[model samples]
Target: MKLNTIAALMALAGICSVGVAAELAEDPEAIRLRIGTGDPVAGKAKSESELCQGCHGEEGVSNVVGVPNLAAQFAPYLIKQLSDFRTQSRRHRIMNAMAEGLSETDLPDIAAYFASRSRPKEDGAGGPDANAKDLFLYGDVERNLDACASCHESDARGRVSRGVAYPALAGQQSGYLRVQLLNWKAGIRNNSPQGVMNRVASQLTEAEISELANYLSGL
Candidate 1:
């Protein structure tokens, strides 16, 4: 594992021992939840001044190996991620410090800034294990496994609802997605107010996760 990944895992394990509610202390400075009010122009300024380009690359395209590509990610999902990182609900040393310093008002701008960018193309085809592809695309009817396309859409464009939030998976870093799925399964990334992802992730095996991550990365 990469150094940052190791650090994130260790931090997550530590937080897990402390209990979820206790670990996720509410931030007094966190931005209020605005349903749809992000500003791409302001977000662009924030990204430049805040040094987001250093890690996420120019326009959030992210060339860094482990870092996620933020371009074209769902705005609500981005907002929640920033909020979670800032509030200590999601544990990452670098992200935590960066988020802690941001105003709640900055969240929407950052989300909008990144969302306005075009999505990066995948480097190659996913070419995951045959069985895994079958499971992700077709699912196991006998076992009641639902196709991932059902919720994420066939192209992984994602769906949004007032109560439930689904994130786009297209062109995401496979390694990042794989680790996230594993974390969700292990109950180490459970700061979400809703439990849908935790439940869904818990149902998947390690192999299934690898396969899905590989597939989604190429979407």
Candidate 2:
């Protein structure tokens, strides 16, 4: 494992299931000093200076329907997305323009800042229905699919390992999730690690994607 990931895991050691990163978000400078990421404080300032909060909202949640919430997202995932944007591996006109201004130091710090925000509020749409739950918890074996939780963790709170972090899906915008899944299925988006999303999405029907998105958004 990378040294920074080790430190992060050590920080997580013995902590309750509530999560250690959530507590560290507010003032992560202390722990961040020893990590590959950056200071949340600086990230907050830079985010504002760059007007990130304008669309992403004050606390990393988005006001727009299709815009994804960034609150409490894993810094590693956020950093990777930004890096992808800068490299055009993940293409988005607005995101690409926005990412161009960030320095290398700014990337992780900004990611850390968003990671510091609290998780997005859950929609009161009730929990996932049977089909959605089954797909999320245990994907169809006959289809050779992996359960969503296998990578995203329970309730899609996200997962972390070694030096990688998967993004949290709970309380994310259903619209955004649906769009992304569709993009993956259509090969419009191919930036996922090891093409995992591409493969998973290819097997999903439109109805299944919608069901899955709705299921995760309320989580």
Top-TM-score structure, candidate number: 2
Residue-level error in angstroms, candidate 1, position 89: 1.3
lDDT of each: 0.69, 0.78
TM-score of each: 0.77, 0.84
| Residue 198 in model 2: lDDT | 99
Clash pairs for candidate 1? 31-104
Regions more than 4 Å wrong, model 2: 1-36
**Model 2, position 164: C-alpha lDDT score:** 69
Model 1: residues with Cα > 4 Å off, grouped in runs: 1-35, 128-130
Residue pairs with colliding backbones in model 2 are: none
Task: Indicate the TM-score of model 2.
Answer: 0.84
Candidate 1 vs. true structure, TM-score: 0.77
- Per-residue lDDT, model 1, residue 197, is 64
Candidate 2 residue-wise lDDT, 1-219, digit = tens: 243453354344321124435455544543342233566666777889988899898678898877889977888888899999999999999999999888998988777767766678656642748898899999999999999989988768776776667788988988899999999999999998889999999999999999898888888
